[model samples]
Target: MTDVAFDAHDGIGAGGTADVRRRMRDELRQWAILAVGSLAIAGVFAFMLAVSRLPGIERVLPWPTGFFAKGLVIHVVFSLVVWFLTTFALLASIATLNATEEGPRLASLGATGAHLVALAFPFLLAPAFFNDSVASLNNYVPVIVHRSYYLGLLLFGLGIALPAVRLLANVGARRLQDFGHLALAMSAGAVIYIIALTCIALALSLSWGSEPGRTFHEHLFWGGGHVLQFLYALLMLTGWFVLLRSSLGETSFDADVFRLAIVLLAAFTLPAVFFYKVFEPFSPLQTEAFRRLQFVVALPSLIIAVGGLSGVLAARRRGPLPWHDPGFLALVLSPIVFGAGGIMGLMITGSDTRTPAHYHGTIAGVNLALMGLFLVHCLPALGRSVPPSRTVRAQILLFGFGQLVACLGLFWAGGYGAPRKMPAGAAHLVDGAVIGMYLHGVGALFAVIGGVLFVSTVARALLRQQPAAPGINSAAGSLTQIKGRRGGR
Candidate 1:
């Protein structure tokens, strides 16, 4: 049952494990299709918001000027909330499929559809924003609370929850070693996220009458949003570990320590949930409680990250690294970006430009890690050839550079007291502020390019090939064969 034991016996060629790999591979391809579409929308909106900051661009914009806020809200909702959650949800579903041969195929498909529905809403109902519809810029889940938004949200919530439930149920049903510890840990994180969603729903329902205006929605989002950070941190940490394993051929961290870290992350939430329910819904005490809890919840990720880094260093001492592998490049770069985000976070002093800088940095790092995993593992498993090593390396570097410049600009602007999320024209006033804003706008433009590269890479890989030749039960098989022939450890 321990992770070490599972790893020792686990091999792609192992007969029992092969079945799981096939199912997981099939599910991942399906999820990848959904992910690509979601990511494209997210990229476009991200590019738009960046372009909006530049002079001469707003006049040529297709939508009305008021649409800026609406567009920002849409971008935040789909890019930040939907896209990330959908990707993590798919990861958990794949883990479940690995655990159980007879996975919840129908429900998994439904979850994908629901996520697509949520993704589609911003485009489909964008006009609603112009027609007297509200755009509540809640911290985490910003969107209009109209019927269409509500319906999409409801389905999205269900989409996230159903797969989690199936995964957790399977985890309980199976033996410990049967489902690898990493998979189980991932599943546990999914459960925590679903519970956080439930808490948000409860808060929204209870506060509608008691609290008015943004307070109601803020109260609704506060605790759940706080908890979701832990979820994101956990998933990002998992992605880091996965990337390390894929790129380095082995991870340096102790399996027991990693699993325990995951357990502690899940355990810490018990108090968070209790604190939310026991305290008044909209009290400052509640807000402070969740804020402090986020700080506490984030500790494990740091520990794991350090452990992973140590492992990488030790591996490098053994031999020269496979620098040509894009996955390897990402594994090295992502943590640096994430750490920059953390440092930017520590510089917060009553909400300046640093706030967005912190988040975008961290989120970009997470995306990079996940993208690396896809290129190294998912594409190969799905019987798709990874792009040229040079191309993949270029994409990774472009993303990292873009994000670094963007965050640097924001931090520089924040130091000058430039307010965060100001209108596009506001930052253009002071010369120093203009430089900062221009840096962000230009960097974001490149970040969008990097994102586009990812989408294009995935599309090319998939489109170039058929749905894997028959007799290949899982995508893992293809990867196993390739690695085997290469004689890699």
Candidate 2:
């Protein structure tokens, strides 16, 4: 493998003239604000969710019959669906920053899409307040079985899909390799997202039953939902690169190896469309195929993670680590959390708290990476640097630690046969399970605090008006300066 010199300005394929870069940076900032705002809004619903789950608190709160379920649906859509997709749009915008012909046009479209998502967001939450709303806590993208809720979801999907399609069309195949690993990963993730949308469309047309309830929605989102996980995983991996680059001053893995991992991740997703062709949408075989696909596709991530660990160790031997840097903390914690989730996934024997445990761990891992990326890399690159603060570092640690403890608590309670998505009072848990639930509740409280700190800190930085300095055009340039300063000290 050859060593490719890192170009600070063009890193992640952000090649453009000064004016174009400025315009792209402005657009990227909006996407960043949109992404962070989505998480902030999600936090509101998350608090209600945690309150409805804790033991004694549930008895005191006057949640309606379907409130918890409805809130869960909204929380997942905003935090998981909206947050992840909006961040992807930001990244895709970076990759296409150099497309002089389509860049301006796409920028307009992307901004419009971002606004559309924001407009549709309230509708997703509106159903939870209505007494007539029905929550279908389906596997992937859960839904409220109302026309308004459905309309909100449809508009949200369209908002993401429009820019994603434009991104895919703009990224030429011949230029893929030149875009570097991060850009390639972002582009590949776009492809996977588009494919997931396609799978959902096919599932809608080919679904076996006419029932308009949970089972129907479950199968409706099953295949596409499974596929969407790959996109999330890919995005998490892309974030790992950004976090690593910011923390270590360079990527730990070989450039070609990084590219290969991205290609394989995207290439594997192409065959997922065929599963719909071979097996019925509701078939056990189809479900199993999607389940197995996750395991199979995870190999690339395993390779990257192993390589990253080795790199981190080598860097550690050379000098002191960046313990003060939140990016470093996030990079270190992400894999630990994600790997734990993967192990817990293997331990699943039934539909218990273990399922939520697995997902929470994995999702938190991804969230941590994106959080760090946004604060430490994206903000600084766009000329909005979050000043060095204990609050930022504390936020990362608190969230990571809280999530880990929460996952452990859930796993422990699951061992005692505690049901998922039920309040402690309603779960009919054993004494042992109750203890674990208490732990879970406490951990979630701390995690929410940490998440709140992150949101406020980033929100403040985003709100500030900062003049563009030299090298603000390149994401890697800001990271490079951080690395140089750390090395000099």
Residues 63-117, model 1: lDDT tens digits = 5546666677777776667767767766666565444434343434534544555
| TM-score of each candidate structure, all chains considered together | 0.86, 0.89
TM-score of 2: 0.89
- How many pairs of residues in model 1 come into backbone collision? 3
Write one digit per residue (lDDT tens) for candidate 2, span 1-489: 111222223333254456655656667777888898888888988778777776677577667667888988888888899999888888776655533232344556776777777778777778887878789988889989887887888888887876676666665664554554444677788889988988898888886556768988988898888888888888888777666655675546565666678888888889888998888767999999988888865798897798788879988998988888888888888888888888899999999999999999999989888887777767765667786578889999999989999999999999999998776577477898988888888888788889999989988888886654443344545533312111221
Provide the overall lDDT of each model, using Cα atoms, as 2-decimal numbers: 0.67, 0.76
Candidate 2 residue pairs in clash (backbone atoms < 3 Å): none
Using lDDT, give the best candidate's number: 2
- Cα RMSD for predicted model 2: 4.5
RMSD of each: 4.8, 4.5
The CA lDDT at 291 in model 2 is 85
